[model samples]
Target: MSEFSELRYLCGSLVAVLLASILLTRGWRSKHRHLPGPPPKFLVGNLKDLPTGGHEWDQYAKMSELYGSDVLYMTALGTGLLVINSFEAAHDLLDKRGSVYSDRPRLVMIKELMKWDWNLILMSYGKNFTTYRRVVQQEFQPSTVAELYRPIMATEVIALLDRLLRSPEDLIQHFRLMAGAIIMMVTYGHKVDSVDDKYVALAEAVREYSAQRPGTELVDVFPILKYLPSWFPGAGFQKYAAIGKKLSIQMRSAPFKMIKDRLASGTASPSLASRLLHQSVDTGGIDQDQFAQNTCAVVYSAGADTTLAAMINFILAMTLYPEVQERAQRELDDVVGRDRLPNFSDKGRLPYVSNVVKETLRWKAVAPLGVPHATVSDDVYRDGYVPKGTTVIANISAMLHDPSVYSDPDTFSPDRFSPTDQKSEGEPDPARAAFGFGRRICPGRFFAEDSLWLAVASLLHVFAITNPDGRGGNGVKGIRWSSGLVSLPSPFPYKLEPRFSKAPELVSAAERT
Candidate 1:
């Protein structure tokens, strides 16, 4: 054959192969056309580029801006992902279409290690989820929660004040102790008197388990890795998994065992675990041993760290904005009085104090990205396709900081939530973003709000929180926030001086009562 003819033939053959490959790939793409998302590169999809740890929300926000609010697509490992960044989008999916969007994304390690198949937060939206949620709702029902927890909360607030008076220099530990005590009391009917309580150790273990090296869960992204034997070289998943299992068992079993012992001895205080144990058989609600154990684990895990993180943020907000603190204190003084502590009934009269609580939640949401939700059925959102089983995230951080919604979104301005500060008739409620949206919203929200408000009001009532003076004559400074799934104020130097001589007397009286 002529050289020109041979070249032509070879080129034609190459073109034919390329055409065949394109046709095959096109067919595959057509099958996934219902899902909208950024174009994926070969093999990696978007998982390789997924941001890790605390700042992932920032990256997700940027992607939302680029791809529009209801963007959807697949991850590298063939897991589906849907990012909902706008309030409207989140409302539409997580609320209007909640049936499909209420399920949780699968976490193989968390599931296997913690055995949380039926935990309210981790379980999919089904009979199990419904049952668990109903039980949680009952336990945290407004009347029940207030009745059982108000005294405990009041006592803990007093304890917090006492600690602040004794070591005003250690605000971080005081906040931690107060938060731990309240949650411990609610969860196990036990009070955490000191930071060194065994409950605190259990909490620390959970924190360590959560803060373990980021890439430790290869199985999370690549499910096939889970099938590999633990004996493989560099398989740290097994080690971490073991630790997680041990920690979860300790955390879970301890609370239930306490309840069981109390039930046996007839000394049990009213607790969720106790209620569940007694009701589970009759209701056929959650009778499995592991299921009941997982229920306690869920409440403890959810209750401890996130609640404490919010309380820390509350203190940080007060410290940073003394003016806001002063205003709240004034409102509390007027409504609640110095002789008495704040209570649920005082909520309406203390609108400014309420605003402070709302703004603190808005200023820095404890769960900024909220929790991941998995779609249970194929759906469309804003002309974008959200396939069944897609991992959906409501980027709450973005919604709270949306400039169009909140003027100067970065500023800590509680006044933004003040009813008098409303510029128009149709302004959004600032508290709307704090707890979460729709059915999956934090069930502990009412309890969380009351605890935060009481703490803030009581703290402000007695203390003149200020930045500690520096050696060079500058103020000690505001907190430097730490990065993680939960954003916490890095331990910073601060001075909490008593605002009045009667503060100590007030704390003592409240404790004695």
Candidate 2:
């Protein structure tokens, strides 16, 4: 038989075996069987109910609404999946009971097949994970970001503005280069001027492959499939996994080796990698070199894609809300003035610009479903209970878009956050749910926000971004949102026009300094 035919035969045989085994074990029961969710099928469980297209976060939110509970439970192929769809439930569970929910699910595709075990974000909760968090947190705290990384952030924004002005059509590429540049510089003291840079390509490739999750892939739900030989019928995942493993290793080791070589020659530029390497110590049964390498790789991969996605969403929002853009520009012109670009010193004075940044994060969360958290022990909440090892997901997009939390939640209104005479408290900050919750929150959040603030402020100050096809200020009609670990608007045509007569001069001057 042909390879394709053989593959089909193998898949059919596997399913038959699975069905027979399931029938034999039908006597088994689930402790979470009473939890709120759609009923499972005889063999597929909730497999057919899982989202195949569109945003998973949105589907999960609808499920939460249909069940009339913020916490949801479902099973696919006998694996338990728990989704926390509201901020309150997420806080009550993932935050208040973090000791039980901080661990990550055994992402078979991400860890076993792709060999991304070094990823601190997906690593199980333990001493190694704690140390990795501490290492990254030390470098990205607000004070440290302000004191040390603001210059790098500002420099990148200026470069981005220059690129946007020259080739406005490649808006997404410019954002990618800008985000990659800032991350490469901060994490490894390496410079990236183009999206085609080898390091940038490597990071992007790894991010794309790593998007696979447990429920999405049969191999992830049944990890024993990982042992299948690459030449085996229906084992294409094994071959794909090999590519991911190669990229993962290169992503972690290449730039790190350069830094180490430079350090040996006493020529290493000060960077997170070099700094951590200098302070490397074998402690808690962890190898310091491996620890630093893993930390730096995770920082680079995580920071680059997320910032790029957020920037794209910011541009999409501007294209769809010209009035909001105009208002932000007015604030920028009034505060920072058109004579020059924005700087960290003016951040406090630019309240409206700050709110615009906050609205961008809330309007479209980059990671719609924040990294999945796993339960290490059985947990009870309200009338339901989550068994140990349940793959817990916080629907971050739902929380940020909760209508009760923010009136007219779909509207992109920066003023929602501004305190008024009648409502002095204003709306709750989306940052609480935007960055994440509990111990698994993004450590680089402060740095990410700082970079985003400068980029948004500078872009608004220099250019008028609008849709080229005259879809200005219209709702997202032609635009489609991508669904993945990080979600953002797909590429759409947008025009960039200089707001000030001296826009080019301003970008040039900023670059010179």
lDDT of 1 by residue, 30-129 (tens): 4545545677655445656676644666777787677654354555445567776678778877888878888887788777654645457777778777
User: How does candidate 2 fare on TM-score?
Assistant: 0.94
After superposition of all CA atoms, the RMSD between model 2 and the true structure is 2.2
- How does residue 114 of candidate 2 score in lDDT? 82
lDDT of each: 0.70, 0.84
Name the regions of candidate 2 deviating beyond 4 angstroms.
Answer: 1-33, 208-215, 280-283, 471-473
lDDT of 2 by residue, 323-380 (tens): 9899999888888887889898998999988999999999989999998899999878
Best by lDDT: 2
Error of model 2, residue 13, in angstroms = 5.1
The TM-scores of all predictions, comma-separated, are 0.87, 0.94
Model 2 Cα displacement at 410 (Å)? Answer: 1.1
lDDT of 1: 0.70
Clashes of each: 1, 0
